[model samples]
Target: MTLRRRATGLALAIATGTTLALTGCDAAKDAASDVIASATAAVASAAQEKMNEIKDGVDAAADVKAGRTSVDGDRTVAEITATNPKDKTADYTVMVNFRDGDGNLLDAVVLNIDGVEPGTSKSGTARSNRTLTGDTTAEIAQALRH
Candidate 1:
């Protein structure tokens, strides 16, 4: 074979191999991205499920109240007060929901205040389970007295 022909053939082969190798790298990158996206979706779904569990609770809105929400570092916090009107001391399971300005649920936290005396109010702090950003407010979602 002629030297010029052999050199051209060798160059063509190298170009083809490089192109295939780059295509394989792109495919690998795409697969990795898909896995990361799926993992992220799973984590988000689990978080929502946990919040829904808190939603399945008793409603005693008349006896409990939530204060304005504040941000302490990356965490959202709020004050909760539970009034015991019963004849005996009772425990309170309070669910505080943090929301955005448009009333979207950002996070929910349960605060347990036990042994509240009759005709008195017990105060406790409720904090977000994860870091929250942007403007947020807090409201009472559910409260159970026992």
Candidate 2:
């Protein structure tokens, strides 16, 4: 073959290879984006399911209270003295007593704070005088509202 013809053939091959490689890379990126979108949707669905479960549990506890059944805590005793629900704001005086399931008190602490909105629930970590396991105060608050 002539040198010019050979050179032309080599350039065409390189260009074709580069174009194919770029097309493959674009396909891979599109696939990755699809997978990420699917995973994000799954996570959002799971979170919504969990929130619904919490809301249902709270509603069930409310029914139990209405039936005159005591919905007290097994691991903690929470005394909510003040629940002043103003317009879009709620103030509460929460007294928590860490206890066993058998009504035996383990430790006690008081938390008086504001800024909880009424009709809408909020949750956070409890800073007690004694260290306790899990979220006892938050559970108590949920049960009380129910």
Top-scoring candidate (TM-score): 1
Q: Per-residue alpha-carbon lDDT of model 1 for 6-89, expressed as tens digits?
A: 334434543454455566687755655454334333333443444345543445678898888888786889889999887888
- TM-score of each predicted structure versus truth: 0.61, 0.30
Error of 2 at 7 (Å): 88
Candidate 2 lDDT (Cα, 0 to 1): 0.36
Q: Which digits, one per residue and each the tens of the lDDT, describe model 2 over residues 106-127?
A: 3333343455565554433333
- Misplaced by over 4 Å in model 1 are 1-59
Q: Tell me how far the alpha carbon of residue 22 in candidate 1 is from the true structure, in angstroms, after superposition.
A: 25
Each prediction's number of clashing residue pairs:
0, 1
The lDDT of each candidate is 0.67, 0.36
- After TM-score superposition, the amount by which residue 84's alpha carbon in candidate 1 deviates from its true location, in angstroms, is 0.8
